[model samples]
Target: MRKDLFNLGPVFGYFFRKNDPNRPTNFNLRTMHFINKLSLAMFLVGFLVLLYRWFIR
Candidate 1:
């Protein structure tokens, strides 16, 4: 949505930034939001699992 994000492409786009109006809608905004949240959830879960393993063994 912002000018800065346009240069970063889909990596930042996955973090809930809306697609710029001039760009194509094939990616769809809602899907981006879902992916962002899912990614964050997985990242947190993975971090916790690693932390648990680090301390448990």
Candidate 2:
């Protein structure tokens, strides 16, 4: 439905939350964080590679 596509509250809530070290995280929350960090790191590496090729060529 058109409503589902526009309703982004849940998605935003999932990624933007308090980071309390003393508070324990469930398996799903930990997994999401890991994946988020991994993807961000990969993106930076790829961007660097692109810039290097651009400068050399």
Candidate 3:
């Protein structure tokens, strides 16, 4: 079967490949990781905005 970037093979290879282990299934860990990263970025942006407003006054 043809696999995309998010496929089990690529995803696992990208993340858990360093510590290989037998598992029941390959979950969508990559997606969750991406969401976590995005949330952090958004939080940082908001913090910077707040700081700028506090200082510019």
Q: For this target, which candidate reaches the highest lDDT against the unseen true structure?
A: 2
> For model 1, how does the per-residue alpha-carbon lDDT over 1-57 read when each residue is reduced to its tens digit?
688756756664656576578865555765786787898879989999999999987
Error of 1 at 36 (Å): 0.2
Residue 56 alpha-carbon offset, candidate 3, angstroms: 1.8
| lDDT tens per residue, model 3, 1-57 | 555745657643554455346543345775676686678678879999999999987
Per-residue error at 10 for model 1, in Å?
A: 21
The list of candidate 3 runs beyond 4 A from truth reads 1-27
Instruction: Specify the poorest-scoring 10-residue window by lDDT in model 1.
Output: 10-19
Evaluated against the true structure, the overall lDDT of model 1 is 0.75
Off by over 4 Å in 1: 1-27
| Candidate 2 ranges beyond 4 A from true positions | 1-19, 22-24
Best-to-worst order by TM-score is 2, 3, 1
TM-score of 2: 0.59
Worst 10 residues of 3 by lDDT: 11-20
